[model samples]
Target: MNTEAEVREEMGYSESNSHRLFSVEEYYTSYGKIPKLCKFLGNNIIILWLIVKANKDMHQLVYQKMDCPELLQEAVELLKETSGVGEDVSATIHDSKIKLNEICRVIKEVYEVVAKGICMLGKLCMHERFLSLKV
Candidate 1:
């Protein structure tokens, strides 16, 4: 079994970085640790909300490239694994379930948005072609 300090070290959490606040991008780039970070923040409302806000800021720059379903699935898996629910029934199953459901809802919304974007892009392309033929 790994100690807490070892886990923190593996996750790129160090005393130096711990003393200073960092933006999401800076934290991610500095650590290069996504799964570990997600597990560390598992189901914490404030942290999750901050993550959502950061994601919204990043979405404008990378919306087309984002794979929401995969990301949500991975998050669920990480939360489950880290929450100790799988290893012991004493873990808070209800909380984990709630968080999982929330992630699924977000996944559904993401798919809906992606589908709408595809439809709009198709319409725009068709309109452009139609206008070109008349000229």
Candidate 2:
């Protein structure tokens, strides 16, 4: 499992970079952790997409969230694993996740799959963190 901090550090990425995960308002706010977590989770999903692309067997069973066609379950799972806030974020990310049984044959489709996953997760990140806000 990749910890958010570990992933960021190993990638030579700091919060200050242009791709800085969040704005100043977010960094200091109570709900900020969710956005940062989403970035890490989404990055990991993108990495997983690459890994899945290279492998044959593993690509067949790409886990996706229910309902939404473009979203991947991995991003939600990543947040659950890394942030300790499972339910709310997953609910937000898993709006539409369609299954792809044969990823290799449709190799070119991986980019779109990944792009949709990224977009869904971005939407999730932008949503107000209900759990953190409650806390």
Candidate 3:
């Protein structure tokens, strides 16, 4: 468990704004709204990704390195519409199970993209460190 000060430091917040850190009692009081908050965030991919990044216990959004298939599909469809990923996804039927393969394929694709992005960020950080040492 992270102390409030550690969390604030990781987020790059100044000590003067420490009031933003919520107490455990406050979290317990607001716990009942979590379900509604999740429902609201369901369609928001950027926010969902931020939650996945910020949460230490991320099993609620991702378990065993996989997002929920239905949620993943929804995110893919939203991206297709907004980012022009091109055309509606056709269902791939197998063993009389419709769209199962499509869901699996999308999940794999998302995992690859996320892995590559993390790798790129790691390389970028190392490059920056190397350059700083040369100064």
Candidate 4:
């Protein structure tokens, strides 16, 4: 597995915005409310893009890529492992799936905007670079 730092570095220079990962600790520190943390992180398009970018490199070449259903299942497993909780927590997580859906929706929409912005900037930069090339 690629280390988190490696992933972060690869993702950092891909766009103008500085991508920050949302840890549970950082979430509590910034928002203090676990319920709203996902929503907050969702709106940060750069970071959301980073999350998607991190997975971009995987499930290629030697193996089939994980589809969305597989990804969701993996995420649930990760949550169970990280939380170290049993059925009660599982029940809570089940109920909170709506939160996950909302966050995913926000992330997708924000990312589309960021992607368009980046493409526009890239075109401008390319034009600038070409003009400079002749100087």
Leading candidate by TM-score: 3
C-alpha positional error of residue 41 in candidate 2 after TM-score superposition, expressed in Å: 26
How much is 30 displaced in model 1, in angstroms?
44
Highest-scoring model, lDDT: 1
Superposition error at 19 for model 2 (Å):
26
Q: What is each predicted model's overall lDDT from 0 to 1? A: 0.50, 0.47, 0.48, 0.46
**Of candidates 2 and 1, the better by lDDT:** 1
Cα lDDT over the full model 1: 0.50
Ranking by lDDT: 1, 3, 2, 4
lDDT of 4 by residue, 1-116 (tens): 44445534544422222233333332212333322433434444444555567766663423334456755665554554444434334544665564665555554554455555
| Per-residue C-alpha lDDT of model 2 across residues 63-120, encoded as one tens digit per residue | 3333443335646644444443333334434656423533322443444455556655
Off by over 4 Å in 2: 1-105, 128-131
Error of 1 at 102 (Å): 0.3
Could you tell me every candidate's TM-score relative to the true structure? 0.29, 0.21, 0.31, 0.28
Write one digit per residue (lDDT tens) for candidate 1, span 1-135. 445465467566675554332434444324345445556656334455566689768866322322457446545544544443333433324355546555555555544455445544544566566668779
List the candidate 4 regions with Cα displacement exceeding 4 Å.
Answer: 1-98
Q: Write the per-residue lDDT of candidate 3 for residues 12-120, one digit (tens) a residue.
A: 5456443444443422213454454334434435445556677647544222222357446645654544332122133343344547667666555665556545544
Task: List runs of model 3 lying over 4 Å from the truth.
Answer: 1-40, 43-101
Q: How accurate is candidate 3 locally (lDDT)?
A: 0.48
Candidate 4 residue 131 C-alpha distance from true site, Å? 2.2
